[model samples]
Target: MSTPTSTAAGTGQFSQRRGIRLGYQMPNFSHAASPRALFGSVIAQARAAEAAGFDAAFVMDHFYQLPGIGAATEPMLEAYTALGALATATERIQLSTLVTGNTYRNPAMLAKTVTTLDVISGGRAVLGIGAGWFELEHDAYGYEFGTFTQRFERLEEALQIIQPMLRGEHPSFEGEWYRTREALNEPRVRDDLPIMLGGGGERKTFALAARFADHLNIICNASDIPRKLDALHQRCAEIGRDPKTLETSFLVFGFIDADGDRARGLQRDLIERTEVEPQLDRHFVGDPDDVAEQIQRRVLDHGIDGVIVNMVGNGHEPGALESAGKALGPLVHRG
Candidate 1:
């Protein structure tokens, strides 16, 4: 457990306009290393990513390996704990889970948790979150797994508490799903710690992002980027907020290998093993050049501000981060 530093309160390190730039999401934790050695492997990856010009480093925020990623029994680290430790192991890269599930902890708990992370990391916390989506984990953890609409309702209620609390305000929120009596968050790092909302729901997600989020990680298909961005623009207009104020990025699943042929094989194996549909347009399964080209053509062409790529296959290799970065860094803006 980490404690917040009082001296850091109300002092944010970054602004929303700069955006995420380029991020590496650590999706594969299963290295050849043993359990005790696993974190060392992760540290190497994070250090490699930072050296490769990746601005942020992320891990999935799930108790179990996701259905398409790995088995439930596979080793999974509690996110904030890992991040607090990661804060010490690396410098420069922003540390956060891709998007935290809202159902796992109470709003005040989550708020205080992120605040503590910010304080520990010298103010590099990005509160990446979404309407809790993984139902199986919720059931396993005894968290309420409601219908999709119900979950969004809960998320809306949760944010009503989370947003104000992040700013060092003890909001007294009473919603159908949650009730807090002037919930207090102590030792906050900044009044404006960036809030990044993940997901691409037109009506529900964008509306909330337009209201409360500093950034929006678009999780929709590549082809849907144009339409979804347009919808985001409208959502901001509906709320009389400037869409530019809410930075945007697309979450791209990738398979980066120096050997194109071997990379293709790894891609096929990953898809087959996970039984998850490959985002053909959004995902790339080839060498670094291929990754860079696709991002420049598809992502930047559509006016997306930034791209967050998670290489689930061969990304844990020793020199993979450098190779992947060599290919993708030219197109990515570093601020």
Candidate 2:
């Protein structure tokens, strides 16, 4: 296997090779019939995604099912553990969390965890992290739910410790939130494990992405994409970094079926069940072709680099991801 090498300053091999243009995010596991069948279904989706030409597969890093998607009691797998299992079950597709909550683990430990995953996946791990926003998980897990500024500060410090460790260096850092003394991460497969930041906070997140991220998965409303892109550019510019060096993608909620009506119906049912207004701007609801068109017009047309979609309604169905991959692979790869 080829060892990973560093790319451009803010970019990593993942984005440099455009390996995340069309990603499959598995955020719902309740589709499985039982606990024993859950992981089989997960493997099936990952295989379907890889066979259908998706470049990456992601799982949400949450202890419980997130609100608006399902009740808190729904089944939720540990992200890194799932990814480690996935690395053995699949080949060629990158594995990661859509965004790991920074508060959930110690920074150096997180670094070692991802490095081990890189070795297991033969260097196909991307550290997708953010200043974790889900307060419920924090509360339930007994992790501190700090102020917004404090969370960002912790995330920054985490990155400071993580970056060096990923490259096989012992880093000693002291911060108000976290401190590491010559922490070591060993048994690495490659030096340049890519990092992806997920969120749309133009002030803090964008600045951090400019400084630390290899890719930015912008999580915002569709209409806000252009403005967000502009803000991201400004952040990069402020750091004297070229904006193009930091690749970007959008996270979209998908309700897709071959039958467009069925897809829309699913979307409607989700709204009714959750009793929360759908952020339609962040959703793609239709058949494969229709969703592809929506993504092209709203996402790719806005200068975003890629798309990571979670098909909450029917992604686990045998051919659901295959159909989506057939339609979307060409669209994002065209970039």
Candidate 3:
């Protein structure tokens, strides 16, 4: 779990005004050479992200292999457990599951876990939840992987139950799938731990975010951002909410390397390791300046508030983040 190193540069026009924030995800999943080895490496990487000035650090919550990532039974770490460890290890950066599956744990239990993590981490935690996807995980865990619609319904009810509880509201929920009665959460989170809703399901998921989440994270082709933003804005209006009130974030995957040849090579190695073709059109890659430029262009062109770069490059390259931030630092100030 690497910590983010920030320079206290004001969130200026480049990022802040546009709500530009930088976050990172640990690349310690199944692509690792060894889960044990990658565990320590990921911690160091988290520290590097902090050193390089990132807003938050996240870990993926998947019990099975994502289709493109190969076999379902690969070495995947549970997000909540990983988060507990990360909370103990890092000091400054906010910790969260990039997006956790609602079906994996009971809603009330999940709320308790987030509050516990918040208390342990001194209130620097974000609860990022999503309707469970990846059927393999559900099957492997012997949890029912129902229809997409059913899963989404479950996810919404989960929010109804968990959010209020986290917010210190004694929540009582009776839904089709889940039932809770006037349950009180002890030692409520110290800070206003914002809820982040993840998923690109335009109508349902986006509306849910507008209604409840403090942050909304979307992952899709870059070209799709404008359309989604428009829809999100529309949803905000429908919900009588201001579009600007919700923080927007993107999940970007790519590599950053200084040497042109080395960068390309690293990208290639990553593509192979992850067993998915590199989607550079939507990724950040190349030399530091190039990477920074791409991020700047994307942010301005699409009105993106911030980016959560999925650091999916080769092993323990400390300079990777530092150099990228240096290149991005100047651009970080541009409106």
Name the candidate that leads on lDDT: 2
Candidates sorted by TM-score, descending order?
Answer: 2, 1, 3
Candidate 1 minimal-lDDT segment of 10 residues: 1-10
Residue 185, model 3: lDDT of 80
lDDT of 3 at 160: 77
lDDT of 1: 0.81
TM-score of each: 0.92, 0.94, 0.87
Model 2 alpha-carbon miss at residue 271, Å: 1.1
TM-score of predicted structure 2? 0.94
lDDT of all predictions, in order shown? 0.81, 0.88, 0.74
Worst 10 residues of 2 by lDDT: 1-10
Q: Give the TM-score of candidate 3.
A: 0.87
lDDT of 1 by residue, 1-335 (tens): 12212222232222443458688898777764688888888888899999998888998898888877776777888888889999998888888888999888887788889989988988888889898888889988899888899888877777777777787677776567777787888887677778888998999999989888888899988888899999999998997887777888888888888888888888788778775666677677778898788888888788888888888887788899899887887787743
TM-score (C-alpha, index-matched) for candidate 1: 0.92
